[model samples]
Target chain A: MTAPRLDRGQRPDGADFPDCKRTFMEFNVLPGARAPYGIRNGAGPRRAVAGMVASTYVSGAESEGAYTLHMLTGAKGSGLPLLSHSEAHVTLYVLDGALELVLDGQRYRMGRGDSALVPAGTAYGFVMTRARTVLMAYATATALDSLLAGAPYDGFIPAEDDATGPADLLKGDFPGTTVLGALPEGTDFAEALTTLPETSVPYVLEAGMGERLLVADQLFTFVAGNRQTGDQYLSVMTQGPQGDMIPPHKHLLHDELFFCLDGAMRLKAGDELIELAPGDFCFVPRGTPHAYQFLRPFTNMIGWLQPGIFEPFFHTLGDPTELTRYPQTPAPFRFDRVIAKLDELDIVPLGRPPEAGA
Target chain B: MTAPRLDRGQRPDGADFPDCKRTFMEFNVLPGARAPYGIRNGAGPRRAVAGMVASTYVSGAESEGAYTLHMLTGAKGSGLPLLSHSEAHVTLYVLDGALELVLDGQRYRMGRGDSALVPAGTAYGFVMTRARTVLMAYATATALDSLLAGAPYDGFIPAEDDATGPADLLKGDFPGTTVLGALPEGTDFAEALTTLPETSVPYVLEAGMGERLLVADQLFTFVAGNRQTGDQYLSVMTQGPQGDMIPPHKHLLHDELFFCLDGAMRLKAGDELIELAPGDFCFVPRGTPHAYQFLRPFTNMIGWLQPGIFEPFFHTLGDPTELTRYPQTPAPFRFDRVIAKLDELDIVPLGRPPEAGA
Candidate 1:
């Protein structure tokens, strides 16, 4: 096979060259392949609302209810309607220009190269002092979509006068958002901030590779959970040694998709058994019993569960071990309590426990 | 702002958290803001074939014409119809079991922890040796959809005899794939391999922060091009000092999207001038003349060009200098030749050169 070095321009009578394969062995080392997320160009459909033009780059329909990514281009002197999301947090990053936000009866000014986290239930509105473009991310899917219902312009809308006023757009109270009137008199910025209701602020975990939770023989990293994303789906990455297996179980309200990042695994979905390797993907729909065992020395997989409310199961069942728990021995847990917790999470166990069974 | 540290559970009388403000001073050090891509769960609709089942996790409609990601599960005694793609390269990663591929008069067996690249225009067929599952990626938009037309079973297909065979499935040559007969006799594996045509193999650059291509005052990393991903788009990451600019130009065949990874940039698209800071995104549709100037020192941005055919323009126009070119001095190029090459790539230069005017 190594004897003949075919010339670059040469073509055989009947043979064809195969395309080269680029293996993502050092997954994180490569800048492009290190991330599995898709990019939605912000150049999609846009809607005009008063002085602001909003466009969605990523909708919840595509994010598995994780978040909705959108852009707001505020024309000079334009602003969004005074609004609040009852259940969703909004994070805004100013890309250009400056914004003066009146939130909770206090005024705050944010300029270019700034970001703000608006906690859920916070009443806030902003006006662009100069023509500004802002990238905004909402923790909930339908909050923004519902708020800007009929304002999307099919094509580009010039920064000219519009008939719709911000107040008129908020005539009907939205489910997650509350429309408020004017600010109260003599409101102090610092005083108002301390008076505001305590809400869970959306936080981005800047976890390094060394930061991970070890549960028994598996090492897990919680990427995004309901607490941060305000969505039901949780994204988790787990690595385990060979022979590590999870008992067959089914979920009631959540579906899961597992992406094999490294090594191999034997997965049993219902009565069907399938094998998975790196770059492989498997979807275990809701109510479909499934279990998997690592078949290689080490197996790394990313799992996403819709309605990520079940993440607490790991916290309750697993120990908070360090990240460097390789060659790990199985940690014992109370089987009865584990089984009961699974039941509470709507997970029906179908097979024997991991250590006791094959 | 620091005076009042309200209790975690305490609520103010009438105020709420306005929002937080975090500037990307150290972009990568920030946990949630480093990666710009979104994750796609591999849990979508599934269809059963004669002796196997298939499902799609990420479709092309979601990835902006980049790639279609999917999976296939083959049962015992099950096989896929012999097929070949005309315009899209198919990369398969074996997740479980084993696959026997019949290609170019040769038989290659691959098991779990293995992968293969099936080039376009090559006739190939595969069968599962045991119960197997494979994850597949197509470099084209609609090739896989066209080949698997009307053969998807809603539920599981038992591992029993079926009427559909390889020939029956390929009554007509599909748009991207062709069905073929068995390999010719007396073909030597080594001889055939040598006789195969020579093609450019896709390569990955494990470039560190220190490695980059310096073209004048700008530093670029050629992330992905036609030789690597086959088609659709080219991804490039570039960084430069403040005042670094690209002259206004428009492409006739490809749209361009810019993702601001760090720092700020002033972008002019058509008649609109928008300033983009970190976490911001902008799209310049094909035929829309645009240019950008970095507004801050050490500004970095990721650029994606649809159809990815013009990536060679950079290679042709710029000299391949060392990666460590910070505080880079400008390199001059022949304007007449550069303009001619731009015209060849369907790029209409509408503004002055980067250093000549602004």
Candidate 2:
């Protein structure tokens, strides 16, 4: 079906349509070619944390609700507060040094190349046994944005004092999170384990070529992180046409990772511009502003988001149409509506929309 | 440290050491060149089930513990027995058509591009909704050899009747398997779901370059299937030097799968000879005689085995040195001991050693 011709005056919503179509039409536009939805680079704004640093590769906004991937470095003696994600599963793969995790009065130590999985509803806290770098993946049915509420937007968490405890750093009555005052006394930690029905096993759903959603201007196939998998995390493959870009934005909660499987793209994470090719990986930590632009005809990459609560954002805004053409005009979009959703998902826009700024 | 020189009469064990060292010594052997210890190739044997055909791509012998990968094609109306593995987890990804799994008095239907994970100790059976092709992965702490004991050596299973039940096809008291005569009455099918401890989450271990083991005539890095991961099926990456070959042998149980990542090799599965290159895949089913010879400087591939029971076979018979060089002489091995272990694992030799035959 032909897309409706976008005319600003005809639509009373005052929604803005990307100028890509106009640019293509002005040239010798190829028939059946659709315009790219938007461009997003891996580089965006930067945020500094006290005694720790994190760089995100993919963000909840980009993952369309999968899992978040990030690289976190904890300084010697640094520790995160005791916290629990009531609806998220967190995984940590130590890349260097050692990490000590305190869970329900039990202590576990993980060294370099070691991994640990913390199921949802488990109260846990972690301290760096030494200076450590870790790859963290948080998978959940809820959005990380909500779970990370009250976390510092920038700068290191202030040193703990007599009046303040770890829980003071987190804000909001986030249903997904519970900051433990202290290890519960006489608590049966085993009761927190996830239980499934006897006849039920973990189910996997595969999305074929014909199954895809057009979110933000890219075509995506959900590989994991669905309701069937208990929304542990979201894994997806995305294809973006050349010139597609996403305006600068940052996620308050959630990390994102990208593996370029084919094609090329230019990523902007903070002030750094990274040009990625096939087989390259990029991590974007929470609170790091980032954007990207496809450099070739089309770029394909695998993206994951942590605490996969943000997936519904795409379903709410994206079109479930098969992507066959490029350079086609986008449907009119209300910026206010888009921004409203982003705000709820803890996504902060750092710049004007591409069309508006251009 | 230098390897001890082989003296035919010095060792009391009649196990024959490979002549690879002598052959290298006769030539201009490169100094410090070590030998490869891992064996990885997808081309192996073929097996026929009643109304179904399966070929293994990776075997536990090559995976170093993690998992076995295989491809199975089912006739339109074919079904497997109501069986369960107490120590292995099974995952099935439907590549084509539909499949109906009967588990715990419940029926789950999966279509193309669908997947299901069957936890250990769950009694289940399956029937093809139509002519179907599927990729199956069996992850376990035990080796698949014991679970598949006493099945046919060749040809399809005879149609089931009152006199011959599905349980009769299996021999030996494999602790992992329990074939239900009929769906148990008042069975709490929900109890079969996999449950993890509160502190448990899936763990991943990474094998580095220094962690490889030499077995047979190849170098392998264990990718999965180790005690750290509870000995789930083994996944390993192997590199074989040029001219390296394994004599024809057959496993009575378990399947092997291979994915050629680099170089080339010639594989003999039963009477069929197939050449493989990068990106090629081969599956060797249980009971099919197979052997392979590396054709180029070196061939690299990924191999996996189900149940992982056969991994000990390599440790028991092959050298366990860190691979430092290529085209190094293989330590001498006693075929009688090798055969003894093979017999216990349900492996049968079909031809003489490569050097003796050459």
Candidate 3:
């Protein structure tokens, strides 16, 4: 029998590039790709908390303490108990399946793509009503890390024999969090929304319910924008058809992140060209040159920009509309509009690099 | 408190498409995107088998009993005992991290991107030597499904207190499988290969050591091809730069599946457009019009085509090359050459549709 041959690449670990210190300035997360600041789907520090698998994506350290992003995945019947984060502003956005959200004792059933924001100290819990459900939780402060940092959980479903109680799982010294036991039984769930609401005390936006704007060929639905979050951050959902969407540009203020919810996105960050899949993430710090291309139909993405200074970039250029999604035939993009506001918006466009792979 | 508004889209589930019968002809899988045949990453039937979390990606039932694909992820020290599949030819390809493989009494150390094929009834086992290691196992028949179908494993790492022994975990009547206890200790590992080997009995190819070819702007590396598997299937790795890489075309002879390994891929299958992220999968059956574009720098994808009759499509159009990765500057694509082989290759070119979003 002939001996097997194994090719060793440049790196000792057979990685293409030598290990470099993680700057956290720019990062990409995809399968087999590692980033100091992000986690790929299915591979992260995970924990079985309350009945769901919580996977930490962006930790406080990775984000330089700006915010933390974690994904909560659970099957039907799995859920979180009522709890309050005294200091963290928690944003829960459902990606798939349905969720019953109990916020401040008022129940609401959230379907796919629904989102809610619970400000500091507001109690909330959720129950998965559908299987293979996914929820993304972004906290303005570290929330799940202190609870999930130990050994990784080995399974996706909690064992039937698991004897650990809520008290045991809630044993961390995280001052902001307060567990309020299980969801109340026999409570009536609030009626589903029909159109986007004018305003609510504690913000909640159902699927396709948001401030809609047509910017170029893309539709921007700001689930949580400057007015919604009190200038904390901007959380928006974008969907559009395929094309080279923008020129290379840099933000002088505010770090931004792109979390792909669906479709395909090709992004250029600094000198690196990256493609984002569903659940993939790319972080571009301020001053880093970046551009994005929607490469396929219905390329959907979620953007989280910190400090909420750039919300006007969309509002200033886009025409506010009632359409929930981009039009079948979109209006031509006005590049001149973006060019006119570049300096005022802290956007510096770079001349396109020699055509890629030329 | 003001009442909220939820935009109820055309579909009751808030999905873009109305429920349609799954024809198993074309499917796309990314985050939130569901396929009738494939499982999204982190969302599939799973089992804790031999200390690793085994996730079923493409089951035999989904593949029409032709083959099965599963992903095995483990932490350091997690592994399988020597086992043999009597009826299934198992191919193990490492996506990330390192693994110690014991094949027919010989131990081999495999790093990132390494792969080995264990033919039917060949005893093989593996131990994860690095943390967060992931291995993709593709079998010529149903192998892991019969082993991992009970329930989803609740965690990423196995529980320490679990009492289920090997015999208990291996109790299924899977005719082909035979467990051989734990890996033997004190065994020396074979040295890694520096250069590509001429040939081996049971095929093994390390990362960057496959049969390399340059077709247009993309680099095609055949880890397992027609000759390698006796015309069973062709497994290839492709990397290229950003561009509209190909015209809309249909394959008349083979069913192909694309799994995004790294970077971004925008694929058009029939009328649907899809962007594949890492771990995302898209399956296009024969006679379906399909096209693909690499939308970002270093967009990488792994493709599996069954009953491999189309290996010549690449070999005929590509020049043999020594380089392992796509070059910084690629040779321009010869579309005329592709036009020349249109009928011979069973490729029917469809004129591009109107520019997207026009």
| Top DockQ prediction, candidate number | 3
For model 2, residues A1-358, the per-residue Cα lDDT tens digits are: 1211111111112123222122111111111212111211211211233234444433344455444444454444444566777666655544344456666456654443234445667667666544223334445444344443333322111221212323343443655677665423331222111212222122112112223566544666654544534555556667654554477777776666665643466666654555454434656667776777665433566666665676776665556654422213444433445565665665677766545312
TM-score for each of the candidates: 0.32, 0.31, 0.48
**Candidate 1 lDDT by residue in tens digits, A293-335:** 6654345666666677677777766666543323234555434
- Considering lDDT, which of the candidate structures 2 and 3 is the better prediction for this target? 3
Q: Residue by residue across B1-358, what tens digits does model 1's lDDT show?
A: 0111111111112122122111111111111221222211121345555345555543455445444545565554455566667776654544444556665446665443233445566666676654223434434556776555545443222222343434445465566666665323332222112111223232212211212455656666554555645555565667665653466777787766665554456666665555554434555657776778775434567666667787767776666654332322455543455666665665777654544311
Against the true two-chain complex, what DockQ does each candidate achieve?
Answer: 0.01, 0.01, 0.02
Better of 2 and 3 by TM-score: 3
Q: lDDT per residue, candidate 3, B1-358, as tens digits?
A: 1111111110123132222221223332322222323333433456776656676667775567677778786655666667887677767787654678988778886754677877777778777765345778887777666755544564333433333433444455554577766777655767544343443246556554578888655788887776656567878888765555376777777777777776556666665655555666766767777777665444678887876788877876688876555654455555566567767776677764323211
Model 2 docking category: incorrect
Q: Which of candidates 1 and 3 is the stronger one according to lDDT? A: 3
**lDDT (Cα, 0-100) at A176 in candidate 2:** 65
Q: Which ten residues in a row have the lowest lDDT in candidate 1 chain A?
A: A1-10
Candidate number achieving the greatest lDDT relative to the actual structure? 3
Query: Candidate 3: where is the Cα deviation over 4 Å?
Result: A1-38, A147-150, A154-172, A192-200, A352-358, B1-358
Model 3: how far residue A176 lies from native, Å: 1.4
TM-score (chain B only), all candidates: 0.46, 0.44, 0.80
Candidate 2 chain A: minimum summed lDDT over ten consecutive residues — where?
A22-31
